[model samples]
Target chain A: MTEKNCREEIIFAGFGGQGVILLGKLMATAAMKAGYEVTYIPSYGAEVRGGTANCSVIIDNEPIASPLVTEPDTLIVMNQASFDKFVPKIKPRGLLVMNTSLIETPPDRDDIEVMGVAADEIAHQLKSPRSANMIALGVYLKKRGLLTPQQVAESLPYVLAKRHHDMLDVNTRALMHGG
Target chain B: MSEKILITGNEALAEAAIRAGLEAYFGYPITPQNEITEYMARRMPEEGRVFVQSESELAAINMVFGGAATGKRVMTSSSSPGISLMQEGISYLSGAELPAVVVNIMRGGPGLGNIAPSQSDYFQATRGGGHGDYRTIVLAPSTVQEMADLMFPAFDLADLYRIVVMVLGDGVLGQMMEPVLLEKKQTHRKLPAKDWALTGCAGRSQNIVKSLDLVVPRLEKRNLMLQEKYRRIEENEVMCEGHLLEDAEIVLVAYGIASRVVRTVVSRARKEQIKAGWIRPVTLWPFPSRQIAAAAERARLFLTVELSYGQMFDDVRIAVAGKAPVHFTGRAGGAIPTVEAVLDEVKKLMQPGKVAVER
Candidate 1:
């Protein structure tokens, strides 16, 4: 409704092939479908390995800039490496989400809002370890008040393409659980 | 043209390609550049255009090669290291004189560089990233609007020269957003059809499209033809934007995102009563030498700003052709220069008696 509907910067960082980039993209695509401008940029180079693969996604009611989020409003660190690499860069009063199973260090800083979700354990409980990224997304959405479960659910088809019809229910359920 | 809409540089380039009548896209995910591929992946199918999320950057460029061979509008994109992987395919495309567009949203380099805005690829892009005595028509867009506007001209240049066209930019340009007017779509331009296209030979002689001209003499002749084409491009396609150059004593030469920062510095300098201007080269190749030389004839000094260790400084020197003093100022590995930093250099350049920092 304003010049900038919701200018939110999010960083997704995890191990290689943890679907961190995919999850970031899902959020960006959903925000874009909600008539927002979105930019998604994935990690490049050796950082894609055990170091830490990260992607930056910006969703704004207005145009975005510099997808490399120097100071993200939301920081989702799925692994220890990511937490170590990105936690200090989170903006004051920004939202920080972590996979409790992987990240041992809690948010030591007082300026940021931190949420720890046993995303891996939840996914395992849901009988899909790969859906941890989705669980993390769900928590992020709930905590930030950026989108609803339905908007995220509506975005699954766009993100997953032809495979969506099969995994749609699971992902939506995951979002519902966290949302 | 449509009403102006704010979009990121990658989205602007994608829209420009669509306006240029791009028929096919094949790209792999890479940092500081995935949005271009993502945009094509989702939009192409809806437009009845072909889009492939190729297994790797290598595969994507080869797919571009296949599409270009058919005289179809085709494009591929990647970042620095991924573009490194695409070099073999690009060399083949260049050798075969195929028309295609390549977008490089560069990050830091020299081996899996971190995913931040960096211009370390200036040498790679300008020196022909691939092997062989070939070149790509490299157009560097400084803003989101130019990202949209330049692609059409790039595609046209590639088609006219029958060579690969590259949009050389970095994460700053790729990820930054600004207002851009989407150009109206027109029918694909009329050009000589490719007889060597692999579309089949039902009732005609077989046509072979190969860069492998094994015969030395034949290869020599082909290389000479390409050399002549590159010369023609240099002569005809030189483009650069000069700002506040009238009666300016000092000139800042820059391109892409760096140029935007310099533009700000120039405006601020004017307010400070300093006669400083800027030369923003839109085409990295065809180096805009004539424009720089023309500016050098009257300007007191030239300052080259970039995101690398002064790669464009070499070109600036060549453009100045030793007539005016040229100085280099830059930062590398995702480091962005501020207007204040550029202004500092401009102030020193105007002094004419300060120690020139050489790296």
Candidate 2:
């Protein structure tokens, strides 16, 4: 029973079709596989019908207090809408990773470190557009350096549905590319 | 099946019921808890058990009443409004002395409240919301794992007392996902057989299973017996988690999702050397009154935080009995009380000669 001290709050935001919830689940799954206490919560309401979809993932060495993330330590945005929505909520000196392929502009924040990646472009090259979420996740894993890309890739079989098993290779490749 | 998996609280709780040897599950679709019904629908049939998506909450709970009469593990889950609809059936279950697990994944209330997490039903749940001279065992889980973990004990306790055990949670607990180790399927406590069940009276005089005793004195006796059973449960099954209570002057009292937030507030208060501690009621009914009264002997003040408009405040006040001042801070209608807001209340009370205890 180690004292719960280290906690990282993250928000993954994107449009409804952008695999935002899956990305949060992947991070949460990887963290759980690494034996850290984790909680993943999607924005639950009418917003999930089609508009903006987002989720909060918290990884901590100890039990999490509140699963909701008010101020995220890391904000990963896949599109322009999410980028504009979640950028202001990042903690000072936090990490912001944006999908440059869809997000035409970067966050105008001086307090946080920003990483712009052509995540959708890379996924398109990999012939798996859905793996773009994996690309942004990989960037966070590589930059945040909390959990490795290999860890998240290894968790793919567990997080993804069985029908999507065919995309594991592309998702893995996308992760490595972002890393 | 034994390995830990990252899953939502509702999903984990549903699987846990399967692991707990659930014989039947009845539910209607409601936000924040529809996952349980969906999961149970697929898994229950797969497990060769009974699952029903009843036409409504009223139908679901009556289904539970029917299922529980024959002496098998039965359950139904719903959100706030749906649970309200099930109240009559729940009261019937209590009067009939049938063991049934009813889960209330609460949401903002008053009426048709939005699908956001809320503890507004604290009063409804702990008070045995339905009717009649009765109280149900209410278990409040603050984490996803706790949601799963408590399901086993919930069934065991329900049968042990022949009462309805309510697993009370809010939208937050139902929607969030966490890593949970699937246990209880491999471990089970041997419980007493349901001899009073309506399985059959084939070999003897037909055993009547009914809550209605038309005779006034017979009904009075049954009510008194139920009260005795409730007393015994209160004596034996009061479950609470006490943190930093020893030598603490300020005590925070909460349960369910609110308790999770209070934990952080307690930690923050402790870091500031305010001697703050917390009491989280795992069993909301069997209200942990004795434990609270024990803490009231030394604590300078008690602050009850809740998601409702201080429904639990009355309980805390009763337990404290004015030995220490009891105050309340809460929000309603999907507004979650943050750690900072609760910590602010703690600091206000810690000020010298500034404690104005709200009666």
Candidate 3:
């Protein structure tokens, strides 16, 4: 058999307001800046508030043909619902980035790599739990060389906007400190 | 290359359009597709690009028609029902041979259907839902990156063929989060001078752009020319993806969300040593009939998974051409089938003589 290619499909899922989409964007932008073709797709239910939100990102050196990641190499579950809905789809030897403050039970698979981070707690320590998304993004960057701190920081203004400029800086710091 | 950012399919498309240097976006609001409009509404005005939330889809598509006629890069998007409303305008755009991009985030249908993702618009998109004989360049995006990446190609095709190009996506595909490399914006392609384009001729003769050819011979010739354009599109624009099909006994044919779900199911089935492969069509209009036909000769059973009841299945049957048994499994009205549901169907369709460890 030919050597299996090592491309990463990362999924970030959580409840509304957890900034699931923002984290996915940060990862995609960082990966793209790293010279990898990236695709980011966000999925949400009907409910605008408190609804389930999940985003999938695929980073590869070759030209990525499809952006929809059916099978993920890593899963970052921030809520119970997010974990329950997508846990089964995680591939073998995949990474699990879970929010210990939210998801209590770890996944059942023993072959996979599991990392539980108290994102909310860390964010609270930073006086901004919402930056938990940024914390999770930092971990992703550390584990997978998808992006650099500088590249991700460049896209901060476009993502965080003027209203959240201070928050953006804080989140960037959180990423740096956490990763 | 720019840094990576996680983005919604809608936001990805919006940013991609900005990157692609799209000049105008005319659209209205609809579920599972609101982000596409919202992204434009928030960015277009600030970018000095045109963005209009028209009262209705019809007005929005017609506005796109006007903008495209001026050789400006234009786009408009809506959901299934709203897309139905825009069909008349689409037919006109096709008839006038104008170039533009139309995105349809499919949902439960026939009328004002539910907001959940559905592929009911497959037939409407592939078989010319609009009146008269016309074919739009239909691109089915299964991932958020493809959703963003295809914009440049979709726009280029529209400009190249002088026809309406469409990005057909279901709610799940549109709403899903995935990483996408937004290519840097390119310089806008200048439209070649068309004698018929409605440019005020600036010291030359007058120009008129219209589809109404009252003369029968002239109308017939125009339609014949359109038929030629469609033939070229079908011949050259076929795009698809094939996975683990060599030496497989069964091939699962699907697209968009269904294809994504089937891909996972195939992986799980392989763990049990059940060999199942898949053929995913990226361009729905130029259906991957050639790929399906080639695979059918080696595969015994053709299983089709879709959100709607037996729509894309028909295409599978036609492509397989009785070389194998074609089976279909679907759930409508926004019901997302689990991997178990798909695996169960796949096992049921395994040939009678074939043996496997019962789950």
Maximum-lDDT candidate? 2
User: Candidate 2 regions off by >4 Å?
Assistant: A1-5, B185-190
List, residue by residue over A1-179, the lDDT tens digit for candidate 1: 43544588889999987778678767876776677766666655446455668888878886442344678998998999889889998999899999998888787899999899999899989987778888888888787777887898887886675954787888788887782
Summing lDDT over every window of 10 consecutive residues in candidate 2 chain B, give the lowest-scoring window.
B182-191
Compared with the true structure, what per-residue lDDT tens digits does model 3 show for residues B1-359? 66455667878877887777689999999988899998999899999989999999889999998998887889999999999999999999988999889999998876887888898888888887899999887888777777888787788788878988889988877776655568864535664554556666789887667888999999999999999988888898899999999977879878887787888788878887888999999898888898999998899788888888878888888888988878888888877666778888887777477653312
Q: lDDT per residue, candidate 1, B185-280, as tens digits?
A: 443567665666777889998877789977999999999999999999898888888978888888988988788778778888888889988898
Best by TM-score: 2
Error of model 1, residue B221, in angstroms: 0.9
**Model 3 compared with the native: what TM-score?**
0.76
Off by over 4 Å in 1: A1-179, B185-190, B355-359
Can you give the DockQ of every candidate in the order shown?
0.08, 0.71, 0.24
Looking at candidate 2 chain A, the ten consecutive residues that score lowest on lDDT are A1-10
Residue A48 of model 1 has an lDDT of 43
**Candidate 2 C-alpha lDDT tens digits along A144-166:** 77888888899989878999999
- lDDT of candidate 3 over A11-81, digit per residue (tens): 89999889887887777776665666666666654646588888787777764544556569999888999
True contacts kept of 1: 0.05
Ranking by TM-score: 2, 3, 1
